[model samples]
Target chain A: MDPTDRETACFEAGVKFGALYHQFAGTPVSAKNADSLETAIEESIENQPGCSAVSVDIHTDKLETTRGYTELTGEYMDVTLRIEYADCIVHAEMEMEDGYPLMRVVDIVEE
Target chain B: MDPTDRETACFEAGVKFGALYHQFAGTPVSAKNADSLETAIEESIENQPGCSAVSVDIHTDKLETTRGYTELTGEYMDVTLRIEYADCIVHAEMEMEDGYPLMRVVDIVEE
Candidate 1:
């Protein structure tokens, strides 16, 4: 079936998120760079087709470091995003998988 | 930021797909029930708020069976969906992970 413009835009946003996740997956997470990584994530989502605003909360306050790599066995980031075509909110969580970011939807509810 | 209605709907669809994947995961795959599973997936996506039509193609023609559980080492399903908000197309692929379906975006392009 053919997708509507809004659906297309939403999916595009997800694609962008996936790309960004891969981009920052293996990077070291530390207080010195957490803010920058979060900003990059927020900007990537906001730059999508329908996204106007995005809130990213990276859980880097307690990252365990071994050598030079951040141990992400139980770390996650929360993402709250707003798009331009619907009246609901999108809440998602990005978790570490094989030391890479894997984004999944937590919920979508009316605002 | 608040998500638009379309974004919410799209995320909802993904959630549904994930649930359905879990439901059908570990089930034996064969010609006997491939059609039914595909239908269930399509219906699940189409029932979402913005989705109108969905195409689901399960790759069960060459499934390898061991005991009763289907070995999904290299099996995948393709889903093409349409929603009522954008002029683009959403194409995704679902692969088996630990005998369950894991969906990922392939692309979103103008149709």
Candidate 2:
């Protein structure tokens, strides 16, 4: 349900990529909420320069709320953005303890 | 040559985590260069708030130079920091196209 042509093209253009995390709770999520969450993430990343991929997925349609993170990969930058949602509240954390330009998604895929 | 106990403890404390990319270039990289790169990354990530992991690896020591991305994951944000290096010059790109809090390394590990 993620990964699109526009996003793939961006990667070819050196735009890089990223995707939202999803958890499965054995139930379905509200279509309205899911759409809203997806829209918010898409617009946010798209607004950033050099951002190539912005995707979201539900862990479990029944989990009601999901917890996860976002992946971002640029030509020289790579990191993950953590996210937790509950009661309609979303919190974000930036985890880059490893160092600058750590593991590239390219390597992760190719390796 | 990655994932240490202190870093592991930080994750246990909710510090979040990240890792550098390595491409194995066929030959081994200089110990001096490797140490410097590793130290720089370790210190930098350890300095950040909510940062819990800092690790580095060589893709291919014989490649002369390597290209990759850094991964960061916080409680609510997930993203990648792209990096390109050649002739000792490192270029970084931030790829957050999809949105906020994309993929959690946890899911990538467990899934």
Candidate 3:
């Protein structure tokens, strides 16, 4: 069977979450540049189709400064995505879960 | 409604593609480092849940050399992912599609 609108919306939401997390995960980030990274992530994901808004919070406070800068990963950030598709809108988020970056749908509204 | 096994598999594949693309994009890349980046990309995404295999190809020839190294993007690479979930397996691919990295499910089989 073909995918329904709801499922497509969910898939699109998942795409945004994955895209947001991976695209910037390995960037060299230090406390001084965390703000810029956050803004870049938000703008990057917002460029995706169906993505209305993106909010990224990088936990620079948790970053290890021993190396001056470290590769970014889920352990140092949280993200939320708002995706609208067809007649449905989706809210999704990502954060560390058992050391893995877990992306999940928070809610979906059909309107 | 709950997503079926097939839908979940597709979603997983999409996640890997997004993660693979985003996590490595913007990295400093030149002919000298493209092979290593390809290996790193394949290994990184293979760690994702339900992802069985990943193949990444970075086109060193297409890279702009004005700065000696260019950032990676859809225009510079192609990727394929294999994901398995609840007895269903999915094959997905990503490449430059009209100026965007278009990812789509290529096939899904149940076993």
Candidate 4:
């Protein structure tokens, strides 16, 4: 059977999320590098096929430490993102370890 | 800086999972259709860059129904997969709705 329009949109969103997750998870995070990290994420997601607006919320333990210590230890980041697509909203959450996103989800939902 | 061997391996695994999830989730499921689903998943993952072995387990609500009823109401499936790559093992879990994977993860680990 052929995929419905919704299914195709969701699948494409998943593909975009996969690529975005790789870009974000591969970066080491520290207090000094946080802005650049967010920027990179925003740019990648916004560039996706249907994404019109993208918001990212990132929380990491490494930001609490002194810059020197954070630079040495790196950070574990949890990223929550809401992306507005033309047809639906995609909500994504990711867990990062040693600067790599280990697990994640990108889902199209009503809310 | 270049990605380490582990990071590159993990990233490629993520890419494979993304593609596999799209393929699997787009198909409607029933008891009669489960084997084909598993076959598609295994073939896709095993063809990834470093994958050597692929296993898939699928559980669904629509399988308990009589075949006729199952054909009318598609199944909601949950897929758990383990893919063995040359460098690491990748475990993935997916939740499907109306025959599309809405959420998922592909993670590489020591186990």
Highest TM-score model number: 3
Between 1 and 3, whose DockQ is larger? 3
Best-first order by DockQ? 3, 1, 4, 2
Error of 3 at A18 (Å): 2.2
lDDT of 3 by residue, A1-111 (tens): 345566567667777777777667678999999999999989977988989999999998899989899999889999988889899877777888998778777777889
Query: TM-score per candidate, in order?
Result: 0.41, 0.24, 0.74, 0.40
Best candidate according to lDDT: 3
Whole-model lDDT, model 4: 0.51
- Tens digits of lDDT, candidate 3, B1-111: 445677667667767777777677789999999999899889888987898999988889899999899988889988888888899887778888888788777777889
Q: Report the lDDT tens digits of candidate 1 across residue range B1-111.
A: 454544544554454444344434455667677888778767865664556777767776666645443732325565555544455444555566687545544444444
What tens digits encode model 1's per-residue C-alpha lDDT throughout A1-111? Answer: 444444544544454444444444456676567788788868865765556777777776556655544732225565555545455444455556686545544454454
Q: Tens digit of lDDT per residue, candidate 2, span B1-111? A: 222222222222222222221111122344345556545655664454334344444332333333432222221122332121221111122222455323222111101
DockQ of each model against the real complex? 0.07, 0.03, 0.35, 0.05
Alpha carbon lDDT of residue A102, candidate 3?
81
- Candidate 1's docking class is incorrect
Give the better candidate number (2 or 4) by lDDT.
4
Prediction 3 TM-score vs. true: 0.74
lDDT of 4 by residue, A1-110 (tens): 23323333443444555555444543556666677777777777777556555555455544545534243121355555554544545454556666655433345554
Superposed Cα RMSD, model 4: 16.5
On DockQ, the stronger of 1 and 4 is: 1
User: What residue pairs clash in candidate 4, if any at all?
Assistant: none
| Residue-pair clashes, model 4 | 0
